[model samples]
Target chain A: MSADADTKSVTEVRPGATPAGPPVGARQDSFAARLRRDWPLLVMAMPMLVLVTAFWWVPALGNVIAFQDYNPFSGGILGSPIIGFTNFAQLFGDPQFIRAVVNTLGITAFQLVFYFPVPIALALLLNSVVSGRLRAFIQGVVYLPYFFSWVLVVAIFQQMFGGAGLIAQILRDHGHSGIDWMTNSDTFILLVTAETVWKDAGWGAIVFLAALSTIDQNLYEAAAVDGARRWRRMWHITLPGLRPVIVLLLILRLGDALNVGFEQFMLQRGAVGSKVSEVFDTFVYWSGLRTGDFGYGAAAGLFKGLVGLALILVANRVAHALGERGVYSRS
Target chain B: MSTTKVSGLAPWEEPGSLAGRIGKGGVLALIVLAVLLPLYTIVLTSLSSAGTVNRVGGLVLVPDGITFDAYRQIFSDSVVSRAVLVSTGVTVVGTAVSLGVSVLGAYALSRPGTLFHRPILFCVLLMFVFFPGLIPTYLMVASLGLKDTYWSLILPSAVSAFNVVVLRAFFMNIPRELLDSARIDGAGEFRILWRIVLPLSKAVTAVIGLLYAVGYWNAWFNAMLYIDDTRMWPLALVLRSYVVDSNPLPTATVGVNGFGHVAPPTLAIKMAIVAIAVLPALVIYPFVQRHFTKGVIIGAIKG
Candidate 1:
C-alpha cells in the first residue's frame, strides 16, 4: 500500500524533492553516514564491481582495435598498427562483406514476416483451450526445446532430417525420394525460420498469455450477452488487447534483427556452405580467426555494431511516434 | 482476521460439444507431440546399441537393444570425462561469482538518486546495444595473458548487463519502508543487503544463477576463441567438435580408451553429449521455471 501510495504521490513529491536538494547541505556530512550505513551493501557489492571492471570493462576497451590493424602474435593490441579508415574502406569494398550484410538483412526480413507472429498465434490458440491440466502440460512440453543448446537442436535436426537421418530412412522404407532440405540453398532462410519457430514459438508465447490474463472477464461476459460468437469476441476483444504487447515485441525484435545466433549459422555452415550461411557474425569469425584478417574482421564487427545501434535508435523513435512505450523512452 | 481471495472454485464452461473438445484436444495433442517427439528420438538413440542404430539408419526410435553404451563412452576415461569436469567447474564457479557481482551492482543501481547510478545504468544499456568486436575482445584477453586459462572463460562474461538489469528490477520492487526501517536501526547498506534484501530475493537470485550456470556450461565460442589447449576444453566445445566439426574420434591429445571399441562415438554418443551438456540445467529447471519467466521481461522490456 505504501509503495502504491509513493507511486501515486510522484507528481507532488517531485518539486519538493528537487528543491530540498539545495537545502540538504548537511547531505554532504550525511553522505559519509549514508555510506557507513550502506557499508554492508557496499561490501556485498564489491566482488561484482571489481570483476566487472577487471573483465568486462578491460575487454570492452579492446573495441579500439577496430581502428587498428590488430595482429595477436605481434605484441597484441598495443603493438598493432592504427590503420584507421583503411579497414572500414576495405570492408565496405569487399563483396563478401556486402553479401553478409545483405544476407543478415534478408534473414531478419524473413523472420519479421514469418517468425514474428507465430508466438502470438500459438498463444491465442492455446488460451482458447478449455482444459487447464492439458494447457499446462502442453505449455511445459513446448517450452522444453528452448532450453536445448544450439548444438542439441542441430543434432536433433540432423537425426531427423540429415542425409542418413530419420526422414531419409523413412523414405527409403516407403520407396520414395527424400527431400534434401538441409544442404539446399533455396530453402536456407525457411529452414532457419523453422528452427527459430520450433525452438522459441511456444516459449515466446508466454508474454501474450500474461497479457491475456490482464483482460477483464466482464468484457467477455458483455460480448456473450450481446450475442457475439466466440470468433467475433476473440477478434474484437482478445486481438485488440494483445496489440500493444505485439507492437512492443516488434520494436524489440527489430532492434535485435542483426543478431541471428552465430552458433546456429556456424553449425549449419558446412552443410549449406558460406554461399548461404555467411551472415555478419560468421563473416567476422571466418575473417578474424580462420582467414587471419583481424583488421577487416574488426571493421566488419564495427559495421554490425553501428548498424545495430542505428536500428535500435530508429525503432525506438518509431515506437515513440506511434504512441507506444519504446525500449528506452517510457510512453 | 479476514478471509481474502479464493481461486479455481468456479465451474468453468464446458466447450460446445464432445466433438469440438476432442478436436481442440487433438490439435493440442499433436502440437505437444511435434515438440516432444524429437527429444524422445534423441533419448532413444542415446540409449540404444550402435548396431541397432546403424540398422535403423539413424535413430532406432523403438529401442531394439537398450544399452547405456553411448553414455558409457562419454563417461569413460576419455577427453569427454575431463571436459565434463572442466565444464562443471567453470559453471559452478562462474555462476557463484556472476551472481555475487550482479546482485551487488543491481542493488546499488536499484536505489533511485544514488550518485553515479545513472551513468552506470547508461553504460550497461550501451553495452547491451553495442558490443565490442570479437578480434579486439580476443586481443584483450590474449594480451591480458589469460589465453588457455579457465579465467578466460569466466572473467570475460562475468558482467552480464542483462543479469544486472534483471536483478536491479527485482531489488527495486522491494519495499522502501523496510529498507528505511533498517537504515533507522543504523544498519549499513551491506548489512541490510546481506541480511534483508538477499533473503527476500531468493527467487530472482535462483533464476539468475541458473541462467548464468547454463550460459557458462554451454559456452564454447569463448573457449574456441581463447583456448589453444584441447586439454582445457569444456564439454560444450568437445560436443560441438563431435556434432558439428565432424571429429567423432577423440583426438590423440585427448584421453581415449585402450580398446578403442568406442564405435566411433556414434550419433547416439553425440546425443549423449547433448544430454550431458544440457543435464545440469534440466536438473535445476523445474525448481526455477516460474521465477525465470518473470526475470526475462524485467531486463528485456526495460532495455
Candidate 2:
C-alpha cells in the first residue's frame, strides 16, 4: 500500500512540470532551473528549517558539552577544557545519579506492570457498551483530565487526598485523623502511578478503541453460534484480534521506558522529598540548573539519550523481525 | 478485514445476563463518578463563600451557600490577572504562529522529492530518535537571549516535527488531480495551497490548532525555566506557585480591624485559580473532542 502511494506521489510531481513533453533525461534539469522552479516551495520551507536548525540541530551539537568540563563562566562550551570521559565516570560514581537511575527504572517497571493494562481494560469495557452515546460521554469525561497540566493534576490530587483535604475532613468527621497521603514518601510511587492512571488511562484507551472497532464482527458471531459464552468470545476472538496492536504498543512503550515523566515527578518532588521522588529528568534539572554542574548533568542526559536511541533501534528491529510495522518503515 | 459494514453490533450479541449487566453498569458508574466527583468538588469549592470554605477546612463538597467572591478576588489581583493575560496572549499568538509555520512547511514537504525535501524530511525524522536533553536546550535558549521572554515559550516549540509530519501526510492524501488542475489553470503553489489545499483541510487544521493551543495553555515548565520574573509568569505557572507549592495567595489581604476583609479562604482562592486555568480547555474541549480520534488515527497510520 505504502509503495503504491509513494510511486503515485512521484508521478504526481513529475506531471507538474514535464507532462506534455517527451521524457527529459532525469539529470537534464539543471540545479538552477530546479531552484528557480521550486524557489517558492523552498521559501515556504525556510522558516521551519531555520527554526529546526537553531532549536534542534544546534542544541544537538551542544551535546558535546557532555565531554567537556563545561563551566559556563569559563568561555562557554568552546573554551571549556575537554575532559575525556571524566564527567561520565563521575556520573557513574555518584550515588545520587545512581539513585535517580534506580528510581527511574523502578517507576518504569511499575508503570509497565500496573498502569499499562488500565487502558486496555477500559477499552474492553467501553467496547461492550451497546449504547454508543453513553460510551462517548464516558470517554469524553475521562479524557478531560488528560488535557490538564501536571501542576493542576497534582493540585487536584492534593485537594482530594492531602492531609487537610476532603478525604481528611471526612475522616476527621468520623473521629479519625487525616492520612498524610500526599507527602508520604513510602507511598510516593503508588500515588504518582495512580495520578498517571487517572490522567492518562482514558486518553490512552483511544488507540485500543480504534483497534477494537476494526475487529471483524463476524468472528464474534461465529464464536457465539458455536455455543461460546460472552467471556469465552472475549477471551478467544477479542483478545486475539487485539494481539498485534497490543504487541506494537508494548514494544513502543518499552522503547520509551526511560521517560517515566518529568513534569509529574517535578511537581511532587518537593512534597514527597527527592530521596524518593528523584528521577533522571529531575536529576538533570537539579544538577544542571540548580547546582550549576553542567558537564556532569550533560553527561547524564547524553547517556539517557543514547540509551533511548539504542532501545528504539533495537525495538524497531525486533518488530521488523516479527513482521510488524514498528514506528517507522524501512522504505 | 470484513467488507461488510458491521453495524457496530454483532448479530449473536446478547444484552448479557442480569448479573453481567449489573456488573458492567456498576463499573461504568464508578468510572464516571471517579472523574466527575473531583471536578465537581473543585468547582463547588471555588464558588463557595469563605465562611463555608473555612467551616469545611478544605474543598467544599456540599453547597451551603454560593458566592463569586473568590473569582472576583482572583480577577482583581494584579499578579493573577496579569498572568491570565500573559497566558491568553501566549496561547493565541503561539497557536497562530505554529499553525502558519506548520501549514507552510507541510505544504512544501508533501510533494515528495522536491528540492532539499529528502534532507529536510530526514532532519525531522531524526528528532524522533535523539533528544538534545535539558541542559543543551536551556543553554541554546539562554544564548539566544530568549530567557525571561515569551518568545522562549513560543519559538522553541513553534513547529512540532510530529505535527508537520501528520499534516504533510494529510496534504499528500489530497487528490493530486485537484492540485494539478489548479496548477494548470495558472495557480501558483502558494495560491493552490491557500485556495485549494487549506479549504479542503479544515478538520485536520482545527485539530492541529487545538493541539498546539492546549500545549501552549498547559505549558508551565517552559515558563518556569525561562521566565524568572514573577510578573511575567503565565497562568499555569501562577497556578503552580499558589496551589501546588502551597504559597499563600499574594492577593489574600486581611484588612486592618477586619473592616474590608473580602479575601476568600486561601483554599477557595486556589481552587478558583484552578478553575480559571481549566476553564478555557473545558470550553473548547467538546468542540474538538470528536476530531481527536480521526486526527490520531491518521497520524498513527502515517507514523
Each model's interface RMSD (Å)? Answer: 6.3, 4.6
Q: Estimate each model's TM-score.
A: 0.90, 0.92
What lDDT tens digits, residue by residue, belong to model 2 across residues B46-87? 999988988887788889888999888777667788899999
**Model 1 agreement with the true structure over B1-303: per-residue lDDT tens digits:** 001102232233224577876887788788888877877787788888878877877777786868989888677756788899999999899988888888888887666444444345555555766777676677677767999899999988888877887788777778877977887898777787899999998887887887788789888889988888887899888888777655755565443565333445567777777777767867877787767556664444442
Q: Which is the leading candidate under TM-score?
A: 2
**Each prediction's RMSD to truth:** 4.7, 4.1
In candidate 2 the C-alpha lDDT for residue A129 amounts to: 79
- Judging by DockQ against the true structure, name the best candidate: 2
* lDDT score at residue B170, model 2, on the 0-100 scale: 86
Quality class of the docking in candidate 1, CAPRI style:
acceptable
**lDDT (10s digit) by residue, model 2, range A1-331:** 1222233334544523545321222234677876776788899988889989999999889999999999899789999999989999999998999999999999999989999999999999888877667778988998888898888999999988899888988999899988878999999999999999999999888888888888887787788899998899889989988888888888888878789889999999999899988999999999878888888888889899889888877777677678886555521
- How does the DockQ of candidate 2 come out? 0.51
- Residue A262 in candidate 2 has what lDDT? 97
Candidate 2 CAPRI grade: medium
